[model samples]
Target chain A: DARVTQTPRHKVTEMGQEVTMRCQPILGHNTVFWYRQTMMQGLELLAYFRNRAPLDDSGMPKDRFSAEMPDATLATLKIQPSEPRDSAVYFCASDDEGTYEQYFGPGTRLTVT
Target chain B: AQSVTQPDIHITVSEGASLELRCNYSYGATPYLFWYVQSPGQGLQLLLKYFSGDTLVQGIKGFEAEFKRSQSSFNLRKPSVHWSDAAEYFCAVGEWAAGNKLTFGGGTRVLVKP
Candidate 1:
């Protein structure tokens, strides 16, 4: 079975540090998305990519966060100068077609101190 | 802007009992709807989705949802509940105008009792 894979299942970083999360979308999938889940904000779409090109990043913090799909198989999300409020579980999902169903990775739980 | 609303924040049901979770959305144009389930500290799992055809869609884990265009609702339901079914459920709408972004509901936390 195909599934999205995410690395660094958990991350602990101090304020002002840089954090990077990685995701490997299922092979043959053309679309990838990054989402942040927190108690305050249930799930916020940070960014998404189609065919390795970003389709939207408006929901993301432009100054601090960045998402990129380096290749068909890999996507990444980075946070520079992380803050305590940035602590949350980040999930990466992908689908072959841009539609309602998306296959999600296990997720990376980040705690910025 | 497209938005999703899950009226119930939390729901509790006994094992073997029926289950229903409400979800509503607002968006212009035809919308794609979806339901996702998340276990504690886990990523989301797609339960089901509606993209035309029959308004009712069946999904994995014995879950189903009905899409009602007039009410802008896609409610999830199951005939029987299991303790393992307890989790956080999210309803979402996929809109092209929103750059294909999925607007999700606040989520409903299910607590199943034995």
Candidate 2:
């Protein structure tokens, strides 16, 4: 079955370190979304892209977090100078064009010490 | 702006019992609605979605939801609960005019009892 895949399923980093998470969307899907999930906040959308072009990144920390779609298959979210508050499970979901449904990857669980 | 509200933070039901999870939303126009389930350490799975057409939509895992425009509610329900159904459920909204930006609710955790 077609599925979105994320790398580094679990990451533990010291405070002030940089962490990068990668996602490979299902082939031919044009829209991709990045979300962070936590006990207090639940699920928050950090960024999204359509056809490899970013549509929004407003929820992301503009100074330290960045999301980019280098190609149709690859989408990346990076955090510089990570903090303990940044520790959460980050998920990547891709939407099949012309539909309202989205398929999500298993997600990357990050722990910042 | 669009928003979703899942009032129940946690729900407990016995196996084989009926289940209903409430979800409400606020948007200026008709919005796309969805229900998703997440297991521990797993990504969110789309259980169902309602964009248009019939207000009652059937989903996988024997889940269904009814969209009520007057009340701005999309409640998910199941005829009989299973132990495997114990998971976190989330309600989300998407606006077609907004590039399909999704807004998710706080989520409701279902605990199935034997």
Candidate 3:
């Protein structure tokens, strides 16, 4: 079965470090979303891409966080000078056109010390 | 802005008992709703979703959720619970106007006892 794939299942970094998480959405899917999950915030949509073009990133911290889908198969979320509060599990999800159901990948857990 | 709320922060139920998790949402127009379950160290799994047509939607693992537009609620239910049902459940609302970005609830932690 097809599934979304994420890299760096766990990452530990000190404050002020840069963190990069990668996602490979299911092939043939046209939409990809990036979300951050925390105990306090639950799940927050950071950004998303449709048809290899970013549709929204308004929910992300523009100064420090960046999300990009350079190609259909690759999506990336990066945090520069990450802070302690940035610790959370990041999940990537993908969906096909004309459907609302999304398939999620195993999340990447980032811990900023 | 659109938002989702799951009133119960945590719930404990015995195995073989019935289960219900409440979900409430706030949005001006009709929105797509979804329920997902997240196991420890795993991504959120879609339990059910409501777009239109029927009010009740059935999902995998014997889970079902009923959408009540008048109450702005879509609650998940199951006839019998199992030990493996213990997980964090999230209710979400999709904003169709804006690339369908989903806003999720704080989540309800379910504990199943044998």
Candidate 4:
């Protein structure tokens, strides 16, 4: 049973703080995706990477949000000077290239005050 | 761009009753469809997916979805509902042109009564 793993299952931070969420994709998976879930927005794709190279991050706020796959195993999403509106559950998912299936992580619940 | 729509925001059903959740999609070409279920405080789990060939696809936990290309809909159905089946269901369309990135629906919350 391979699964995507995310760190800091829950995070609480004040406005203007920096928050970092980490994900470990399944060992053999090559594509990684970051998504944010909110009551208003449902699920929004923030960014995705293929072979440790970013494919798109258009949905993400470039001014404050950054997504990176430092290596094959680790993918990270960071928000600098996070705002109250950034409070949402951030999910990390991974899949093998050419496979339409995406395995999701447990998600990190972020609460910005 | 591909988009998905789950019309029902919430549905309540009695245990042992049949269940159906509607999903409609918008895309110019043949699209990859998927259904995922999310339990409270948990990640989304794949229920089923339809790429091609079969219009009706069987999924985990006794769930199935039928794809109707003419209507642009992929509706999920379960023969009988159980109390444990209560969860939020999401419909998604995969955009192959964009590295198969998924566009998810607003989701429908199912509440099963005993």
> lDDT of each structure?
0.91, 0.94, 0.93, 0.96
Q: What docking grade applies to model 3?
A: high
Which tens-of-lDDT digit does each residue in A1-113 have in candidate 2?
99999999999999999999999999988999999998888899999999998898999999999999988999999999899999999999998778867899999999999
- Ranked by DockQ from best down, the candidates are 2, 4, 3, 1
What would the TM-scores of all predictions be? 0.96, 0.98, 0.97, 0.99
Clashing pairs in 4: none
Off by over 4 Å in 3: none
Worst 10 residues of 2 chain A by lDDT: A94-103
Higher-ranked by lDDT: 2 or 4? 4
Question: In candidate 4, what are the lDDT values of residues A1-36, reduced to their tens digit?
Answer: 999999999999999999999999999999999999
For residue A64, give model 1's deviation from the true position in Å. 1.1
- lDDT tens digits, residue span B39-85, model 4: 99999999999999989999999999999999999999999999999
Query: What lDDT score is found at residue B88 in candidate 4?
Result: 99
Model 2 chain B weakest 10-residue run by lDDT: B93-102
Winner by lDDT: 4
The deviation in Å at residue B94 for candidate 1 is 0.5
True contacts kept of each: 0.82, 0.93, 0.79, 0.71
Q: Higher-DockQ candidate among 1 and 3?
A: 3
Across A15-70, the per-residue lDDT of candidate 3 in tens digits comes to 99999999999999999999998888778888899998889888899999998888
- On a 0 to 100 scale, what is the lDDT of residue A95 in model 4? 91
